[model samples]
Target: MSIRKVVFPVAGLGTRFLPATKVIPKEMLPVVDKPLMQYAVEEALAAGITDFIFITARGKGVIEDHFDKAYELETELARRGKDDMLERVTDFMPEGTTSIFIRQQEALGLGHAVLCARAAVGNEPFAVVLPDDLIAGNGRNVMQQMVDVYDRQQGSVVAVERVPKDQTDRYGIVETGELQERVAPLTSIVEKPKPAAAPSNLAVVGRYILTPRIFELLQNTRTGAGNEIQLTDAISALLAEESIYSYEFDGTRYDCGNKLGYLQATLNYGIRHAEVGEAFREYLDGWNNSRDS
Candidate 1:
């Protein structure tokens, strides 16, 4: 009831990233100093989520290893008197947090990947975080903001942002009744509507706070675009049964699923990194001066 669990749908093959993603999972791709998945996990952790359900695939074993304790590495770092590096490695995963990985045998759609976590999710409301959508929040993270909305709404809440109307075809667009400032009650949701046909510019992002009932809806959802079951279709059905709201979360989201967005995230995070922030900024300024001259 307090939203203690979260589902991470990370099983997709990163074909967009081509050769780099051929071996490494896109979720494992680093932004600056940390992997994309680590940021998602840290965000959820900030929201007090203790149980994590990772829907994974065959090549995603490295992700599991990423979260697991690096005993040998830690020991070596300690032996070498690298306390700072050892702390960083040992602190990757905090104690008392549970991580469960479920294999998505086939590369289905996002909806299907979520359905795979039904057993692990059981009957509680859970959050679904897509690591590819690296959201940098202002003060409060996106998932935390949605959980607060769920507390008041007592239904489902999806994270939405005002995307360019022309890019409506790229994301699931939501139709809303009226705006309660940042939050709005959804009237309907259409997956990947064309620019001309899109209901509104507000498009659903990666963060979701869904009830367990969604698993049932996902089970009956037919494959839509890309010949795979669409989570938007399931959420559209749930709209008929209960109230679902969309929150225009206060955050900057990087669509790390594509090459441009990934590079942008790396540059943005790199410039602000604690260790290299000032130096990176200086390097950028020097590069710009050199290029201009």
Candidate 2:
């Protein structure tokens, strides 16, 4: 079946961002001119997803508003004849695409956040994109690449990338069976294993194309690491029942949830922007030369 719907768990308090995130959501933070969440949304759209299920919290109304029509801004832009800016703001949501917002009242774990979208997701296979992981790639989007694997295998697939052995404990590390060019048949997954205990360096990223059976697994999933319901636990159960493969997504992922990663993403994207790329390149060159002198 074609994967038409996607779930976005945006309910986290984003405490990492502190004072600024106390009012605004970290997902709303801009990379260059676009917000982080928009990158995920655009990625999903590029991957053929037409329906969006946003599991949001209290202070995340701005997210919904961001994708909606900004009438006042549009009118002002019209008055000033800023047609370019007008198009940019008004083109947030594409026609025929459906967006549904569900409230996740608690700051539960990732598994619980996904379960909150069960009703909207129904029994069909759906994609889950974590906005915190902003991926940069050419051609196919990460989700699209996973969907291609799902199309061939007809099972669940998650995006994985090779992490340093020492860093394996920081992520859900996957044990491999047979490796194709880009896809690896996953044998098992261990969440945050020690460096010596890690089966492989392939770590699961935030992008997932999950079957409906996962919702059931998550419902009965007991608290694991950090006493929070881990998505890895549910995925492990799914792996036991059926085929779950890992795809090494051809992309550069930025963990916008971390302060350093967020700043790096902003600087990287800013330096690549058509409007600022040349000037920013010169600025960096001058700074580097001065430091050397």
What's the TM-score of each model vs. the native?
0.98, 0.97
State in Å the error of residue 117, model 2. 0.3
Residue-wise lDDT of candidate 1 within 1-293, one digit each (tens)?
Answer: 88999999999999999899899999999998899999999999999899999999999999999999888988899999999998877776688899999999998799999999999999999999999999999999998898999999999999999998899999999999889869999999999999999989999999999999999999999899999999999999999999999999998999999999999999999999999989999999999999999
Could you give me the TM-score of model 1 versus the true structure? Answer: 0.98
In order, candidate lDDTs are: 0.94, 0.92
Please give, for residues 1-293, the per-residue lDDT of candidate 2 as tens digits: 98999999999999999998999998999998999999999999988999999999998999999998888989999999999999889876799899999999877788899999999999999999999999997678788888889999999998999988899888999988888978878899988999999988999989999999999999999989878789999999999899998998888998899999998898899899999988998999999999999
All-Cα superposition RMSD per candidate: 0.9, 1.1
In model 1, the clashing pairs are none
On lDDT, the leading prediction is 1
